[model samples]
Target chain A: MSNPFQIPEQEQHELDQLGAELRDAMPEVSLSEDFHEHLAAKIENSWSIRSAFQNNRMIRMAAGLLVMTLAAAPVAAWVGIWPQQKKNPPAIGFEIPEEVNVDESGGALGDSEDNQVTGPNDEFEAVEWSPQRRVALERYNRLVTAVASYELHGQDMELARFEGFSDQSAWASASEESLWLEFARRCAQADLSPLSAELVARCTLMLAAPLDRNASKQQRAAYAAWAWLLEGEQAKAADLQMNWPSAPFLTQN
Target chain B: MSPSSDDLLTRFAAGDPAAFDELVASLGPRLKGYFLRQGAQSSTAEDLVQNVFVRLLQNASRYQASGRLDAFCLRIARNLWIDHRRRGGRVFSSEEAFDRADPRPGPVQEADSGDRAVHLRSALDHLDADTRELLELAVLQQLPYREVSVILEIPVGTVKSRVYYSLRKLREQLHNLGPQEDLS
Candidate 1:
């Protein structure tokens, strides 16, 4: 009911004085022509090194792929550990069987380029590249990776398969989950709205979607809380306040 | 007419060092002022200003014309400052360098000037990097928070909050340390 940021009148006065002082403390600098030449030369030297290091296309693409994989892996595992279940029950639309195969059969298409699983929505196509679509795909990938990492195999493998991303070949493995988490966290923390927003959206979707038996009850609940936050459902988020194992780092608490 | 900053960057990337000279001519003063406002000594600020432009030359190919030119330059400058700070050469103590060591006209040395400047500099030093950078960009350089956010890799909301908090802190410190102002 009360505003937390209400500064007292006295404090406000103090702040005004500080502002005036701040205005006066700033320094003045003037650049000369000779200094500019020296700087240019230094930069030229650094560029030569950078060019030498990243000159090849294969190296660059490989590096990009490595970063993507590392970033996506922990997310897959986290998703794997989370629970899932079909929403709307069997009452609304056709419910796919819970035991659909992810890798070999046409289930959630195991992390391969060939397979494409059809979702409940008849019109919903596979991941596309528009801003919204990219966001959606990134979310899906992250959720799949997190769930997969946590041990939800089917959906994990399914989402990966659908997205044509492989845990084994794509540079994301059990060992690299920590690195991926770091990358994702750093990227999300920075003002990369497209990346962070997608992370939020996918996190929401993963939370909103029903969880399966293998998924971590606490992680699923946390995802649900995360989803609730994304949906502006703070009340529901408050309700799912379970003591999740992925407590400290994952929730940003 | 001399090439614009953007034009020089493009030409420099195309291997024309002369274009780089034009860029340095155009952006040098602005760069120098940015470092100075962040409390660098004039000579030190000038050095870093030159370093920023040279760093730009190395990374010229990375510059996209569609991107914010000023923000790009500022980001490079911020990185250079961080590096200089990390070298353990420049810290809060370096604030005195700005006030006392610059070659140009600096803060007036009235009876209260030294104390006032010292208090303000210390307050800024106490602020977070994001807050300090935003204040430098927004207040000192007169840039909008939008561009500051881009350069600092923070959201506009964050930029606003940081500037507000840093300013609040600075003002509080100033009032505590400087001559009292009438609050009528």
Candidate 2:
């Protein structure tokens, strides 16, 4: 390959073997182990960057959607149709089957001072400090109120029965002194029956498991390599591919 | 190049993260090594490679796949390298970045891939940046003259002549490094 500058730059020899020798001598290089971690972060950012380039297209498409939405707004408003944003919490309500008898016997043996749910420092306030636990307690309290109102008797009450609700194992595995378990015990010790309180606790404690709707047990990890990033809203948010699947439901918000 | 490597662009364009992953895993070393071959430090090479992927993703929809995945990546990598130089590549401090960027013993020295190629690496390091880049494009990547022309943004004739000169320079440098068994 060196015939060009040979004459112009004094005496020189052609050594085409250098390419093959370099190939033979240099081993194929390996990437750093954190290459994928860096790549994933870049890909996520690229999704946002790709969108910026098509902001014109997005604006046009959004305008078209807005016109159609405006046309249907009056009829939709009269009929009481409301589109829920993905970030909004689900609008779920269930009728409670039985009434809370509320053990008002002035201080039954089961209603010991230590048995009630309370903040870490305040034993009197029946409120939980953790937002997640508060959600559980709120749901539990709302169900008790619904049962007492006796107003709604026979709605689809699926939650009342908690049929097909997984996470029984999670609830069962909790230590006896778990705060939720103690709260459930308090309910059971109240004039409320064992079965109903157990059902309520089982239905609610599932939310605290730190599981994503899309996650599964690893079973085993490939210490050598990482799996691909899941597709959908993540892939689509990039605005590059249209065939990615829609994200499955239940983002906790 | 196997069809599997060729399809990194195709699969990535279709939004396959695994394909994107495979593309990075396959092409990342080439890019980082290219920067290193051109005398970039470990952190700079890593940052350049990262920019290449981000650029590829940004242009995935518009980039016409020409059945050359390495060329596609190298094109971005070369451009980023230019930009990186213009910005006056930041001085890297802290050997910590060095230890992290390379798991092997000191840069590419202890790459378990075997064979230090110490003389050749040292010889390549001695070459000027432009000479090393020309060698990287023509000799190392072995890209066709036309692809090399486009990536370097030079005429094919210029590529041919410069690569010849670069080869002569590298051959001379290796000669000066003296009778290393590997090269001899």
Candidate 3:
């Protein structure tokens, strides 16, 4: 008995014939004789460069040392270990007044005369960086690095790096409007002078206020135009501007 | 060839130059064929294959032997093509202009049975980009349906159905063109 699922012999023959024809028709490509030599040379060159980079450990060590020295300078000055020079005055330590009442916001709430006290107090009330704030700052740095990496590498690498860090989930989970606004505020506060103009523009555009609810069609179009401009798609941005003349972002110089 | 692809890849990752050479020998033709069939120029296909190898060398540590190397390499090729299209400002539309822009000579036009070959080429090209890709992966690459699904990022069922329909479409197009040219 023949199997019900089997293709008819004629149909199978035709398909087999088609496959044969296709195989014949398909072009056979081969690398040139020198291709392997060229690839091997490239690999060698890459290896040499990589080895050179690895061997230059002294430069990295020097950089680390410089950072450490810079970091310790303030501590040395604070501890009065550095000798006073004509240009650089000796650091003076401050003593917190014992009678001063400090508010939760770190504001002095008592008279200066009543608060006058000698020597540094271990219990001095000051606005210390909270753990949450520290984490936020770290996450912000990672976000900036991630964005830069995305620009330099590509989306897949960026996504992989992002997946390695859990803090990114918080940003992703947040509302887009709030996230953009927060990013804008942070970008404004950041020293973005070191970043390229394109990155600065990306940060700026990311921070751009989302279209207001009940906004006109022109406003929405303008926002999109600004977004495209930020993303370096000048042609699309120009088209949007042309179509939506009333867009406020387009009007801005 | 004694060791599997996974073994070769693992050795390649360990910086075994011989293993790398072995991989290059094994994968080079397949990669070149895939790119050429996908309408890349010979030079561009060579460049793409080189890039894939370079990427593999760089990201060797990230490879998991459990995952098929062919699928991984094909995915990279696909990504490179996508990036190439994006950089050229070629937006995806019904008719992919980039595929048509490929300057390389397509399927052996000078074959003995020229009309049939030409008709088959036209039919193959006429299929939608996805269908064409499916055929390339399933038929031309001769990848198993499971591996094809992995490369295409679709379910095995979808692969089977899509491949069936794509083949049916190709057959129908051939039938419409004229009687099948006898293979014998």
Candidate 4:
């Protein structure tokens, strides 16, 4: 009896013949050594850049940052600084300092009293506060703590960003003051600079009151306060602010 | 097959640029010819080959020599081609397209050296891109119906029938072209 599943030998022969024909028809192409030389050169050009990015140490650091950012909340909770869950969102009871005295005096954190902060060529003043400014400072504190807590996990940086650290909504609804402060804090803690410095400067300006009132005086205070915060030099910042030739932009609430 | 392409790849990853060079040199011409036969202009074929190497460079660290290098390389080429088509429609003339479409087209075309290359290439132009790719992989690649099924992400049996159906269509197209040049 003939096999049931077997393809007829004749049909198989035709297939083999066709397969052979197609194989023979395939074209032969060769690469010139010139191409190889060019490729080698290109690789050499890209080598350093790739090596810089692929440095095992940097990759490990980035990976560590990612893990930290993702695990921050849990870690923070474990350390007893943050809440375990958001069953009850905390009420907005944070205080905004009236004039962030940037003069060189206070605690290990820095002096809070002398307040005579000044700016370039006496153009900008030291410390001045507004309702909006207060919120910003509080937000900055929260994000700082968040990042510090995150760093404990040793995760990658990009992954941290992916896991909602970069989500605008996390800070968007925050009072403009809070948002600016948080933005400042993020800049400060970031591994890189330029953008952070600019953001800090912008945050100070946005919180400044209408120019007509203290006008020249207010500018000096804003700059002094900004300079102090960035350098972690509070006493001098405060001293510069106190020397301002006009009234403060903020009043204690 | 050969030692796992992945093993070769891992060696390349261990700073053996020579290994990478050899890999590229060995695969380069065939890949270029594969694209060219499918109707890719020489420049287009060159671009595709270059892109494959560029990708190899970028993902060298991720290359797993345990897997089939041919499959991995083919997968990369296939993805690039698919993306190219998605981004800018079809790239090759139908014959060249058919010739370039299969991961194993070089062999397929080689096997059927007679009038089929010209006739099939021409006839292939009449079919949709997907059908042409399916037929090329099945008939030319001599890929088991199952492998074709896996590569194209389709049912196994579908490959055989599709291959059979596409060949029939190609033959019909050849017939329609009249008894001009014999693809004997």
Candidate 5:
């Protein structure tokens, strides 16, 4: 295509002469002799200010990471101690079903006469606690604590605690399936009827685990509805609730 | 050979203070002329120039070597001008302020060439703002059409057409002023 800005050869020459005449007619304006010096000083001052700002940003980032790591250290230690502490003689009334036992040998434990057992105790002795299993248990316990804390308190403390355990470097060796199963078991064992928005959210994320092939459609829908409600997607949650296949087990806030 | 403006900008970006000095020296007059021609007072032009350089330094890291530094600098100057306008500051008209007080006689005027210069300045004042700016960029500043396009954020074709019409109008004004008196 021809250049749009181009003019005919003769007109171009005339325009050039006009340009030259205009340039000649224009008054000459020069900057002060110290113009360059003043400009350089201003540039240097600005550069220093910008450098300080960037340095401040990097320092703030480093400090934030440090604060986060320090805050997470104790929770990480608590999670690490959980699996070992659970290995003591099974709490008196804690019982494990045949199919879902997590003991090292994968054997089912005898049923307990009392069903009021509380706290972190090994109800089952069937599956051996491998290093991987220990890490998974740690994650499970951390998430459970996070959910419980969020329900009792508010989002901020719970989020900090969750972020603590969910830090990638801390749980690098744990398998997601193991942690997921533990989360599911913890949720199932707890009475979810008094559910908080926080617990509902945790349930939604945990239920998304691929390992739970046995969960009924109603259970999935219920979890999904709760997730939607907690996420402020009230309309979607209401729609799902209206078409629910069965009555939801969890209480809606 | 002198370094290209882009080269100087790249050096400045790389933290060479002297390169910044080189840039200021090279582009300072043109920038001042731009502000003056656009009707800024000499002091205001100087202040605007300082502001432009300050902005350039602050945003140096964002400058891409592949881009035109001249256009970039002019864009900053234009934005500052717009901001000044928004703040409700008066922009003096260079052509209307025909009797600008200066110690030095304007470079183009010899002992007897003042009338032609006055006529040209008066003619320039009559053009609309956009047309005058287009003429300033294409003719007085001598920027390439492409660079003008970037600075004004317009198509080169538009710049060309506008320049053509602006020059035609200016030529008519100059012709109507009749012949210049003999300069011999």
Candidate 6:
């Protein structure tokens, strides 16, 4: 393999120039003047309540540290009690993760006073995700694990085309026009009487999305191998895995 | 993906209203634009920007920034996007019908003038999700290749070459659309 980084000087110069043009061509996104003021006001009004339910422990930890400091101050000043001068701005005392305040609508939830808290964890229970989303995530993880661990699932291709497919839709849209679709069609109709028997049924419901009807040959084989693994037949999956073409699935791309 | 001054973030964490305004002014729009480029809707992009501000309000970006504040912020935006994907994924609920047009009303909405930027955007939409993201970070976000490499967790060389190929592909798509524009 030739060295990728060692571009000739002429090409490197062209690339550098191209880079500047690309930057200039891509116009910058400018916000309205009021946007900053409005967002600042909104954060000031709502995020404290948003933070209270975000995480209970961080506040408790901060409070505990404060109490420890107060107690130690008296001990150190026992001989001559003195008051400590306050800093210009009081410490906020807690840090929040970037996503802590957001809900699906992309805003803080619970506008009513109920979201307000005198102390962290004092008011409402801060459930980040509801029960339904939690279960869906869990099932998705299981399917990813099953598919990813399959010996035959070694290709580096991505099936990210299905941006908006759900289990129900996948099942509804299943057709026998192609092998992967046929696999999905069968899986969609899966009966759950036995765990092994339901492997096909779980295929669409569990994975991000089933293979498309027009998926490449390797895509179909990849799905078939996952079905085999989901049914506990690793050897069969491995055998089928060998026939995959140069590319693989499950990469970020 | 916006440039946030670590110093301003530190002041904001300490509850300075001026710093808060400055940070929001500087970071909010660009961050929202980044989200929009990554395929989020207008409302969703606004929400994503607000969420980043909320996190910044809680502490100094200084805590995370080792001199590369933009990288630090972009990493947060990326994680929020991943979380949004999982929560809003198709399993438990259905997505709004996927619209081919961006809903934000601005220079991007000019559908009739044969705007070159519009053509560029349409061409960009033709690429796959990952490739689009790579180009968005490396080019649109204006982050250095090394910074983008760290955020995307890929080699700097690979990032540069991929950006080259992606732009080449995008340029071909653009040429197919019309004749006046040249990304070369």
Superposed Cα deviation of residue A180, candidate 3 (Å): 58
**Total clashing residue pairs per candidate?**
41, 0, 0, 73, 11, 5
Chain B TM, per prediction: 0.71, 0.79, 0.78, 0.69, 0.84, 0.79
lDDT measured at residue B126 in model 4 versus the true structure, 0 to 100: 73
Task: Give the range of the ten consecutive residues with the poorest summed lDDT in model 6 chain A.
Answer: A84-93
Off by over 4 Å in 3: A1-17, A41-253, B1-3, B89-119, B182-184
Query: Tens digit of lDDT per residue, candidate 6, span A1-253?
Result: 7676667666566656654555554445665456666666667776564466344568767877999999988888863543222212112222222322322343331222243223245365554554323323333333334333322332323321222233443544443223243333222222111222233354534334755667655465545544443432332332322322332222221
In candidate 5, what are the lDDT values of residues A1-253, reduced to their tens digit? 7776567777767766776777887776678777766766676667564455554677668777989999899999999998656533222122232332244443322222332333364665444444323422433333344344333332232212221133433333333333333233333333122223244335445445532456555454444443333332332333322321133222342
DockQ of each: 0.28, 0.22, 0.12, 0.13, 0.30, 0.14
True contacts kept of each: 0.68, 0.45, 0.25, 0.21, 0.54, 0.29
Candidate 1's error at B184, in angstroms?
7.9
lDDT of residue A253 for candidate 2: 21
Q: iRMSD per model?
A: 4.0, 3.4, 5.1, 4.9, 4.4, 4.4
Cα RMSD (angstroms) for every candidate in the order listed: 30.8, 29.1, 30.3, 21.1, 19.7, 39.4
Sum up the clashes in candidate 6.
5
| Model 1 / residue A28 / CA error / Å | 2.9
- CAPRI-wise, candidate 3 is incorrect
Give the range of the ten consecutive residues with the poorest summed lDDT in model 1 chain B: B104-113
Per-residue C-alpha lDDT of model 4 across residues A90-177, encoded as one tens digit per residue: 2223342333322223223222343333323455455544323333453444434334333443233332242212544343333333
Superposed by TM-score, candidate 6 places the C-alpha of residue A140 at a distance from the truth, in angstroms, of 71
lDDT score of residue A67 within candidate 5: 91
Chain B TM-score for candidate 1: 0.71
Q: Tell me the tens digit of each residue's lDDT in model 5 across B1-184.
A: 1328889888877779788778887887778878877888777788789989888766776677654677778889989988987888667878533235244554245424656766677678778888888888778877789988888889998898888878878878777765764222
Q: For candidate 1, write residues A89-137 as lDDT tens digits.
A: 1111222223321222223311234333455576877433233332234
